[model samples]
Target: MSEQNASAAVNIDITRIMEMIPHRYPILLVDRILEFVPNERAVGLKNVTFNEPHFQGHFPRFPVMPGVLIVEAMAQTAAIMVVQTLGKEAEGKLVYFMTIDEARFRKPVVPGDSLHIHVQKTKQRGPVWKFKGEAMVGDTLCAEAEFSAMIMDN
Candidate 1:
């Protein structure tokens, strides 16, 4: 992490986030980053809607957001934390999920709900980082998980 990001409050706009992470439409889970604490934590936002492609097969009629997607969103949020912590040096770097522990789905996430994803760094070693993540829709916890990932330059 750079000294500027370490001492200063960190925040990244959509354009910069796009340049740092390679995920795109339908797959790019985070819409924008709300806050970053360098190597500590990051908050991200995702506006869920009925128009999302996953709704087609995830459920044809009832249309409840899949649990896996919620977990995926949390993972993406972690990626943002990791990337920003590395001071955007992760450009062209690939982050692969190594493990997910204590994952729990507390409630059903649905269309039209805005997801607030929060991820905090717990530890880091070499290229591996561990994080705790949670997904909430309006104050109610929808899902959460503790996961690890390995960062490698692509």
Candidate 2:
């Protein structure tokens, strides 16, 4: 098999994700992608740190990771799944979250915690894709949502 086939068959790292997705610093919520199964499922990681851009305005003294950013992290992970599945064709394309449904925040995410994000593709029709996403830290669930997005060329 080729390198592309191997990537599709196994877990992907930060470098591979960076090559597919256009998100950069301050916006790239996912730190690394652990596993991907084409259109079926994917796992990603985000390391919460005190130095993140949101920490400055989210709180002054007791900084807590914002729920929206957490959701964005999940979205980024989902984007990785789609991009990896589509391969090089995903470059220069933007994946916009069309809807966020059934979102639940169970716990507060703070600095020094490595959030494990898991996403599974629930459905796909033409340009739109629906995903079920969850974020966890150890045994505790931090956030979860069912969202949809449409891929657009940028």
Candidate 3:
């Protein structure tokens, strides 16, 4: 890890994450943030389990985590970075997806997997920010995407 990343590494639990973004259970994909670099980047984790609602209807025999939700996890990671960058005043503010590009699902994510989400800021213009994100299971890349979003008040 670079000096910046090493200096910024900090643990953010679900409660703090909830205070930063407006997502709740079922929709709140990120379980914890392992590393955060304010405006630069963030690394988060999502523990995939069989109890999630989508698994029941998605595929009972082979419950694969939806690709879209993985992307959403990436977005949520980016949102946390945004909020951290902007400070306490930005808490509870909403981050809305403006675009998702070059999304690719390389491997299927299943229950009992620990999905690690990594997101880095690519650009920023006022409230709008662009990011590149990757979802990984151990060393294997499960999904990746480039996306942009805007922060707004409630």
Candidate 4:
């Protein structure tokens, strides 16, 4: 971990997350970063709610958060890991999806559940970053995946 990252804040609120990445409103999935170990690992959080627009169409009878959105949450968490690690130098950069492997949605995520997104850095080279992420609600595993992304100036 870089010196700056080593001393990085562990708790990151939504306002701070918004400054890190270019996401807002309905599309911004992560609500807070619960744990950040700079370049090594990060745990992001999203409070699933019925008011979300996707739930309206995902299922009328039994609303469920889409699996694809879970993966997007993981991607965003990984991006924050990079941004937090590099600090201000990473401000104007964006992380783009390169690949997603071994993705699996084990259970449905519903409203009233707090989705815990845990991601760890598996590898990094230049602007490329690889990670393994898992989404969970309480003790149940909701999703898991291995993914890669590239950080580029926007």
Q: Whose TM-score is greatest here? A: 3
Which tens-of-lDDT digit does each residue in 1-154 have in candidate 3?
Answer: 8775564668899999999999999999999999888779999999999999999988899999999999999999999999998999999889999999999999999999999999999999999999999999999999999999999998
Task: Name the TM-score of candidate 2.
Answer: 0.90
Candidate that beats the other on TM-score, 3 or 4, i.e. the better one: 3
Given candidate 3, what's the lDDT at residue 17? 94
Q: What is the C-alpha lDDT of each candidate?
A: 0.84, 0.88, 0.95, 0.93
**lDDT rank, highest first?**
3, 4, 2, 1
lDDT of 1 by residue, 66-151 (tens): 88888888888788778777774787688899999999999888888899888889999999999999998889998999999999
Per-candidate clashes come to 0, 0, 0, 0
Best by lDDT: 3
Better of 3 and 4 by lDDT: 3
Clashing pairs in 3: none
Which residue pairs does candidate 2 place in steric collision?
A: none
Q: Which stretches of candidate 3 lie over 4 Å from their true place?
A: 5-7
Error of 1 at 79 (Å): 1.2
Question: Which of 2 and 4 is the better model by TM-score?
Answer: 4
TM-score of each: 0.89, 0.90, 0.96, 0.93
Winner by lDDT between candidate 3 and candidate 2: 3
Q: Which of 2 and 4 is the better model by lDDT? A: 4
